[model samples]
Target: MDAASRQDADTATPEFTLRSVLVGLAIGCLLCFTNLYFGLQTGWISMMSLQSALIGYLIGKTFTHPSFTPQENVVIQTTAVATGTLPLAAGFVGIIPALSLLSQETDGVDALKLSWLQGVEWSLAVAFFGVFLAVPLRKQVIIKEKLAFPSGTATAQLISVLHQTPLPQPDGLTRRRGYEALQSDDVAHEETRVVVEEDVPQDVEGEVVKKEGWADLLYSFGASAALTVAAYFFPVLFAIPLFGTHLAREWLWSFSPSLSYVGQGVIMGFPIALSMNVGMLVGWGILSPLAKLSGWSPGPVGDMATGARGWILWVALAVMVSDSLVSLVPVAWELVRDYTGHGKREGHEDDEEEPPERLVPLKWVAWGIGASILLGTLLVWVVFGSDGIKSWATVIGFVLGCLLSVLGVRALGETDLNPVSGLGKVSQLLFAVIQPRNVVANIVAGGVAEAGAMQAGDLMQDLKTGHLLRASPRAQFYGQLVGSAVSIVVTTVAYSLYTRVYEIPGKEFPAPTSFVWLNLARLLRDGSLPPHTGQFMLAFGLVAATLAGAKAHARATGASWARWIPSGVAFAIGFLNTPSFSISRLIGGVVELLYRRHLAKTHTPPGREIRLIIIASGFVLGEGVASIVGLVFRTCGVGAASCWGCGTGICAGCG
Candidate 1:
């Protein structure tokens, strides 16, 4: 390519046309809705983005020639993948409003359900605001500082591998003659240079020629389906058994003496699920048991359970708040130091580091934010404001919602922290502070605030990804708007239909919304507390264990003590994961070690070896898919029947 052509290619904004945006939105929405459907059916959060990224990579490689540079290919693949997966994120955002509608319908009271149009409006607004907020922050986090977003790094690495492989040259007499001549030469040398280079390896050339074909596609799809099935039906089988047993024991003991063992056994089967289960066990099981033992039982444990739940809710909220505050302090301090003369010498010329080209200008961000806010406000006014009391209260609620969102962003640096629980607590407290009638308003406001926070976080991630890919800021902002709109509409419709068709008569689907209620109940009963106590305790324990392990290793092995400590911890943690997952990881690690050992015997290209690792990642993805599918079937009451004699329930046939 000419220099001008190269310049244009380098500088030109990849066109994110409306059509492209819609295509991306559609794909994302489809994947998201599918995942959501399965999630609701099985209670597993499938990683949709991984699927999208994989598919994007395949498509990019298929369409683009091997001659394309790694960077260029990455740009194409990432954009495709990100766009394809946008709907899932958008759908999640829409779920809040949909749930709100369901609440209102069931309760015959005012709830915070935004109409389809309103949801879209709010999504657009959030997208716009997020773009602007993220752009300023990007310089600090990504470019200048280079905080590692591991996912992005992995994506970049994959692209590099795809680009580095050389396609086979067509065979001809000239090529044969040249090769023969070069091979025949006693000392092959480049003109004017006597520099010696290592011979190119065959394995390196093989990777370029080994294009992903039908087998890969079929394997990915089958693996995904199988993994999802396994995950859904046999979560316990995949879980760390010992932890599950402990949780079961602790929780069951609170309910009934007879069930304690069973509960313990359950805990023994699933470890990672321990944190939440143990929290519940302590709060409900142990506390209730203690309360009963003390003759202080005021009501049924379930009824009185609100107090413990509330306590935990407050602690969780506080932890999130405090963690955000602590993290931000250093970041903010650095920002100030950078801007002021404290860090760099005063009046020193600003280094000529290349100014990052603007992706989305400030003006477009303002427009998006304004539009989102206006639409969100309008939605609250209509759906929530049908009653005069509700309408007035909702107006105030909307303001509070916006305020809380801003605070959440500032406090958390991202809106992923669910504000609903905190909001619920606040509402419950308000019920005590204000009249009971106003409780509805508080709940509405809290839900909206939570939704806003979540959407904001999503927007930030999307913007960050876009910035990295060098996508036009305007296109990203607009794409988000379109993506969110599609997601809200599709998700709402899907949720409504699913709820109607698959509504379990008495059993409520454990939506994230329930956590809001749990939090609110907790707040009303007790109050807030520290959230990070458990994490802190865990950290302390880890440190102590590390030191102890090091000391023991030094005494026993006479080897470097510190080296053993990390490995010891890793081994223990690996054992803590579900046996299936842990085993798979262990096997992969073993294979990698073996490969490296063999490579040492015969000098092979490092790049070729790395490709094997990438391919192995597909196994992890397969496991995840299996888990999801298993959960879906189990939730739908299909159990092992859906897996065609793959045993019953979660662990019917498991050893």
Candidate 2:
């Protein structure tokens, strides 16, 4: 090749260095613990791509030997995102916990007991299939269609901005000179000053408030972590009696002071927080009392089979599933319209062939997908037993999972929302007809589909980032492989460790999403709805569907009142957990509203919103980390009973 041709080839194919892959793997494994902590605490999983990218850049800066290019950082980020998704993909937060809850309800008739090796094998079997599934679609979905994957595009922008200037000097000379210039009056007044003043917010007295982003982050993190640890020792801190102890225990009315829930609320914002509290009041205040008065739920408050918790679980699941399915109509309509050639396109499809070197070999994808399917089937058969899920059913589930992944990716690309849970519900409904009365089969089958959707959506986003950076798809794919392998081990171990220490469905880790899955499995297994459940479910489902439709209409019409409409999904989630969680979220939501509506009325700070996010993220990370640390203490023979709030009469229950 000529010199110009060689330059083009070099630019097209950047080498994936061993150091970058290792860095990515290491970052990814650590985030696996953090993500699982968030996922189980709430249903949300924080994306770590931006965080990973910045961390990787810092690592490269600290280590002067091996240079880390933007392309290599892309690899690191891709690996981290892939591994961060493993907790959900491996069924740790949702399906596995749901299974455990099922076992608890059934008195261990059908318990899911997997050894460490089996856990790793099960995770690997379900996780990698989605990576291979996204390989062939890169050219079509990412390059040609050019669908805007918003998260991926945002990560790319951040990377580009980070690399705009050359790296700073290693010694203090260049940095000192720059800092000195910023402090000078003449330099500050210059129109084109090196430091951007727009980012610094002014206080009430018109004086510049020096940025304390790191300080704020550390303070919030420390406070949340300390609260979590302290709550462990003084269990009374976990619950505040809203009414008397009788009402607190019997009616389940108490305020849970949890920093983690407040942190989650800050990110979720006021509307969702409001909706969740509304749902909580309806479920706990209205429904629970009515059920008990009418004797529909005759058992104690905590009884899963015949109590208020179990009864409301079905209603919440119905509402959530209905809302998700109804919300999908617009996206599905656009897809159908486009496919039929009735919808508008950016332009006619280009028939020009893409460069051969840029494409992932079709043969490789085909082989990988085939292998994943076979392995998944074999593992399902071996682990779940032939009596649980038949071989044909397992194969069918995998096939359906792969198909649903297409829809999942499309939804993610267009709307920045992956309806994995909805897709899993669809899978569950399908199995309800095909293989009814098998609780294990129902849950496992849904898990298979959910895992595929989660992994596929995550990988596609990473690939979109890679595409934007002009990074080699092949290299990123390799990084994804390494990340997936590492996550399969790390996430499984983390899940096992947490489950051993904390009760899955208990206060510390409610696993709300797991309850949804568990209730649905129970419905399918017995084919007999609980007393008053069918009626209540139908009522909640209709309400959820209506609200979803109205929200969509309001958005289409640009109605100003749209923000007032509560999210059906968020409202339903309120019924899945205790009232205390919603109360804490409400507190955070009120604070967020006050800040946005009242504070910074003159001119909002550029990085003010980011500072709030940092605070929220810190709170979540601190609580999660504290939980893991607390697990270590327990393992080292710390008394679990000391953590119980039994001595405090305010909580009503004693050990």
Candidate 3:
């Protein structure tokens, strides 16, 4: 490449134009739909982003050289990754539409019915609104203070890997000799010595620069396949035995002397499934046993298990809202600094590089916010009411949602309030104050809160990536719009299919419900806590563990602590997942370790590509396959009888 081209490649702005954003959105939507369809068919939420990223990388490599500008590279890579992953997102989207159709025939379809069009519309509007809301807050959270939004950190690391270039060096020249020459008094002598040193610089050509290879592909494929198979044959077994072993252990231990064998069996069988086992031991085993002894079978706790009352639901909503509110403080501060004159500092030109001019001014943020509220109101009107009263209530709810979201952004700092549990608590508190009559409203409210939070969090991460690559803010904003829209469609579809095939008589499909609704219900009704709180505490307890893990990740693996934290969260969550999932993750972890230790041999290539493939493919296949199997079993008239052998079986007999 010529010098001008090279300079352009190096210094060119990362321009994610309206066109690129639209393309990304289109790709993201397509992937989401495909993933949703497959997820419903098979029960796997496919890894759309993973596939997109890998494909994008390959395409970029094939068409361009490593010397390509980072901006161009990101555009090509993101496009490819988005395309590859679109199917998964599509699959998720398809789930809701599928379920909505199925709910017409199913009895007690209250929980099952979700209007796909409404969901999409609201998701788009709110997601768009979230981007505007997030922009003002970015500088505070990301730049000013650098509160560790670890996911953003990981994205930055990934970008660095994708953009990094190596320069050739001359043959060996020791630093000792160079230092001695530098110490010489004569300037001419030093200049000559420097030239000589440059002429005989150290040779680094033989030194390995790690790159992704066939092994990564094999590992990703194998791991995804294994996880899919495990989720297929034994869901419940996958659920409690592997994922929620703590609950299972507690149940078994409840029988004490009578079921000692069962408890022993579990411990001996799945040692890695510790979090759930511990949780169950504490919640069901120890707590229940003690409750019985004290004659304190709290009506509230029982009610929570059987069905959440309206008051309980409200409380959950309150908790979720309140917590989210609490978390937005830092984020809001960041926004003021970025857009307005509030936080400007003298001689800070280095920090405030001129943000490119935009068609939509800061005033447009208010317009977007208004549009979001209007759209949300329309959705509520369609879902809950056609009458004027329902219309008014829906409007009120929409306004409330927007206000809550804004307040949440202002108070909480950034949106990643643990949606299942944390936001549920906020909703619960609000319900208590409002005295809402229907439990479903509280549930819906909480879902909205979570969706908002999730969208906000995602927007922040995307912006962070854009900032690092010097991509235009508008491009990042649009890309998110595309991604969220597509992802929602996929999620909806997958959810729909899974529910249809695996509708557990009285229960909703557990996965979505578990993370989203049931856990919230648990918190609101019983004031119960999630396992993450314990894990967070445990992180503090094990300083050595943190240091060791972080160091190993950074030094040995060439990954930052930011990556480790999320991975650790995934691992902890995995421990709470089905045994099959834990087993799959364990296998994946082992493979990763081996690759790092034996194969890579201290020259590790970026694992993001491999991980993206495995995680995306595994999630998609697992969910998709499981759904298909459920449909087949349902068609065959093999109800609860089929699930008897292993608790993971799909039999609805117990209910």
Q: Give me the runs in candidate 2 sitting further than 4 Å from their true place.
A: 1-15, 54-69, 101-109, 162-214, 242-244, 344-359, 555-564, 597-600, 640-645, 648-655
lDDT of 2: 0.70
- Whole-model lDDT values for every prediction: 0.37, 0.70, 0.37
**TM-score for model 3?**
0.58
Top candidate, metric TM-score: 2
| lDDT (Cα, 0-100) at 309 in candidate 2 | 79
lDDT of 3 by residue, 1-655 (tens): 7644643554455556444444444445544544444332222332233233333343444444443444543443344233324322221222233233322122123444545565555444344545556766566454554443323333333444444522211111121111100100100000001111223222221111123423443454455445434434433433334324343333221111111112112211222223224433333333444443444443332222322121122222232233233334344564567569776644434343334462235676788767776776676556545421244444444455444444343332222222223333465456534434334444445444544543454455445544555555555555555555555555455444454556521222332222324344334444545322334333322532453245333533445332233222222232222223234433433333443354235543323323322233333333433444555665576554334434432222232
**Worst lDDT 10-window in candidate 3:** 183-192
TM-score of each: 0.56, 0.84, 0.58
Which of candidates 1 and 2 reaches a greater lDDT?
Answer: 2
Tens-digit per-residue lDDT, 552-623, candidate 2: 677558687765787776687678677887899888777767765653474554434444545765676678
Best by lDDT: 2
Ranking by lDDT: 2, 3, 1
Q: What lDDT tens digits, residue by residue, belong to model 1 across residues 202-317?
A: 34432532454324445644654564454444434233334345432322221111111121112111222222233343334443455444544434322212323222333333
Report per-prediction Cα RMSD to one decimal: 13.3, 8.8, 12.8
